[model samples]
Target: MSFCLETYLQQSDDYEVLINKAGFKDCARLIRFKADEVIYVKPGEVILGVRIIGVPPIPIGIIENEKKLLIPYTKPCHGTSVVELPIDKKEIDNIRKLAI
Candidate 1:
């Protein structure tokens, strides 16, 4: 079964936020998420089960070493943030499937 990103965010507090309320470019810079790891999806691509909202073809970074998911979360009022949250091995595999 596939894990939903939105559901996970709401139901689980196990994740960690590396940065909050920051711009996408900044987040990309900080994490240095490997270019290969970045997944280009539609602005509203439903990852896992979460509708990933961001600029078109948003950049989602993954760090293999830390098993962290680097996502750019955007809101109209606060701008976007680079969030680094820990994910399980299964979830990681699912994310890789979404990348294209």
Candidate 2:
């Protein structure tokens, strides 16, 4: 399926997202968290982590070369504009296995 970054950003925890599909209305809130922090995502929910590139007023691609995922402001005490995962793929895969 095609992805929409605008829709994803609108789903932030502090923000709200609305979509109309098959004559049905779907709504969700956007949630933001720091890298390495744990946030509870409900079942059946689609979670996406997008990397914010460059400063405000200029838009950039979240996918780097269409392969690697980008993360922003991984350090502590940074602004709320963080976009990235602190854990590596191995750790994420291990956690996924554990969940199963």
Query: Which candidate number would show the highest lDDT if scored against the true structure?
Result: 1
Model 2 lDDT per residue over 1-100, tens place = 5443345445544322222221111111111111132233223322233332322322111222222222222123433233332234543443333221
Clash totals for all candidate models: 4, 5
Error of 2 at 63 (Å): 9.4
Worst 10 residues of 2 by lDDT: 22-31
Q: What is the lDDT of residue 55 in candidate 2?
A: 29
Clash tally for model 2: 5
What is the lDDT for 23 in model 2? Answer: 16
Error of 1 at 12 (Å): 5.4
Tell me, by TM-score, which candidate is best: 1
lDDT of 1 by residue, 1-100 (tens): 6676666777888776677788777766655544336766676666656777765657777776777777777678887666667766787777667665
- Kindly provide the TM-score of model 1 when superposed on the true structure, using C-alpha atoms: 0.67
Model 1: ten consecutive residues of lowest lDDT:
27-36
lDDT of 1: 0.69
User: What are the runs in model 1 whose C-alpha is more than 4 Å off?
Assistant: 1-14, 31-36
What TM-score, to 2 decimals, does candidate 2 have? 0.19
